[model samples]
Target chain A: MTPEPSPSAPTAAPPVPSTRPAATLQRRLFLVGSLLVAGLALSVVAFGDLGEDLVYFWDPSQMAAAGEDAVGATIRLGGVVKAGTVQWQPDANSLKFIVTDGKVEVPVEATGAPPQMFREGIGVVVEGTLTKSGVFTSDRLMVKHSNEYKAPEGEMSAEERKTLYTTVEEL
Target chain B: MNEVAEPVATGVITGGWSYIWAAYGVTWAALLLFLGRALLLSRAPDPEPE
Candidate 1:
């Protein structure tokens, strides 16, 4: 049975439920969303400056398509060294060759010695400027080769051994 | 002897696994830490009104 209220007792209102947890969660979500947006903006700004200093690699056909805009700008031209176009002068220390992407051919003139793996029909990336005369003058030449490894079937022949160490002069 | 020798393997990249594992470990550790913080926050006791 319920007890009767005393005449001298003071009456009070019930307590209200707290909304602090939901408010805290909403504030945290807003903070995280703002940080994500700011991070994306910062990345966009950083990538905008990447084109100014980073060198671009282009194929011979792309170079031809770029036309006069490609001249005087330092770029890395990637293509295969055309066969029967390699001319190396040891006495003058000059190396000249033609790079082709099967559709377009670009003549390249490079100074100093090339890499050991540099040969005809091999992929190469030459870094330099293109002249008005349509010759790519390169100071840096890099050879591109596959990373595959295969076991020899048998002993290497004498001729194969000789060609392996041969320089461009003997090509 | 005229027997052919076995060819040695070359150019296989074997040195970077440690770096890859370390990166994954750090990422998982950070994710778990954030998850634990979220769980604790969800189960936290409400503040008493003054």
Candidate 2:
């Protein structure tokens, strides 16, 4: 039988229940731990493609802020070929053009066979670095295409930029 | 985060079967771990009697 309430217990205290479950707490902690571990694992694997150099694309505005540190920094610049400003040294495999973002212009020099779609008046993204000559040496080039779905036109050059830069649409 | 208008690459997994398989492997492992954690939580032991 339950012991009778003591006189000092006249102010009877109600029975109290435990607020937390030990196992539940442990498991919750384990789940959170697992989540954190999983996140860490994914980060390591994700960084596998990013080399130690940690290069990134930058606009002409950002180039100055990066300072001398910008040298040797691999970057990709996206812009259009300024009209009437393309100069290709055909014998040397180098094509120099003014790349603009409608804000500032950056000179780019690419030495190699350009992508099939490479042309003037079209959007392009260049991957490379800025040189001592203040020109970007591209490693890769891409030509942007319209989603309208149509066949591509051919190359652009000194003659084309001067004449064809005006007629945006195909004949 | 470069120009939002232009996509860097198409979303389609065109590299090859190897790249596709690797992505699926990571996805499945994460899903299984999440399910396992949920089951453990649902089966948490009840509080013992005082």
Candidate 3:
């Protein structure tokens, strides 16, 4: 049956006002991004804990370039432990020595049994901060070993520690 | 725990596990912060509309 051609059907969309404004979604995105970046920058500076870039590591040569900035920062300086420079408090538990790159010397003091790999002319990493005397007062000492074998410090250092601490307790 | 506190202790914090943990934390946080800064400064283009 050839029914009469129906008129065009109406769409179900809500009517749009002729004068209504269109939203700029890009503006919202830009604002969100800008605010987030600013927030992160502020936090990074305030908490600087996350910014370990301020942590300094230098040999004597590099340290000359990294002057006042390294005053209070924890640093790691590696070199050979100087011979005839190691001093102890009459007890072997605490030892102080100089680390040299064969050019300049860095003072390192460690207060415990030396690591197995610790020996004169061997590489060591001393972790600590610089003091007013321009000395590296270290609380920790780690030594480098070869062939995957560690030569742990025997009873010599341990005996020294026991004696030192006993004396401290007695005093 | 201390040897003096407990009066007779042998080993408490012997190994360097704590230092290892501290290093791990600092490293991860620093890396994440670096990545965050890099992403914040990155400029990229939007995809084409379907």
Measured over all alpha carbons after superposition, the RMSD of each candidate to the real structure, in angstroms, is: 17.1, 17.1, 19.2
Best by DockQ: 2
Give the DockQ-based CAPRI class for model 3: incorrect
Worst window of 10 by summed lDDT in candidate 2 chain A: A10-19
DockQ, candidate 1, vs. native dimer: 0.04
* DockQ for candidate 2: 0.05
TM-score result, candidate 1: 0.49
Instruction: Tell me how many residue pairs clash in candidate 1.
Output: 0
Residue pairs of candidate 3 with colliding backbone atoms: A116-A151
Fnat for each model = 0.00, 0.00, 0.00
lDDT of 3 by residue, A12-131 (tens): 444434325444466677799999999999998898685456643466656545667756778887777776565555354667788888887877777776664465677777888876
Query: What's the CA error at residue A140 for candidate 1, in Å?
Result: 0.3
Q: Give the winner by DockQ: 1 or 2.
A: 2
* Highest-lDDT candidate: 1
Per-residue lDDT over A73-163 for candidate 1, one digit per residue giving the tens place of the 0 to 100 score: 9999999988767877667777888999999999999988787667778889999999999999999998888796664556887677677
Off by over 4 Å in 2: A1-56, A150-171, B1-50
Error of 1 at B20 (Å): 22
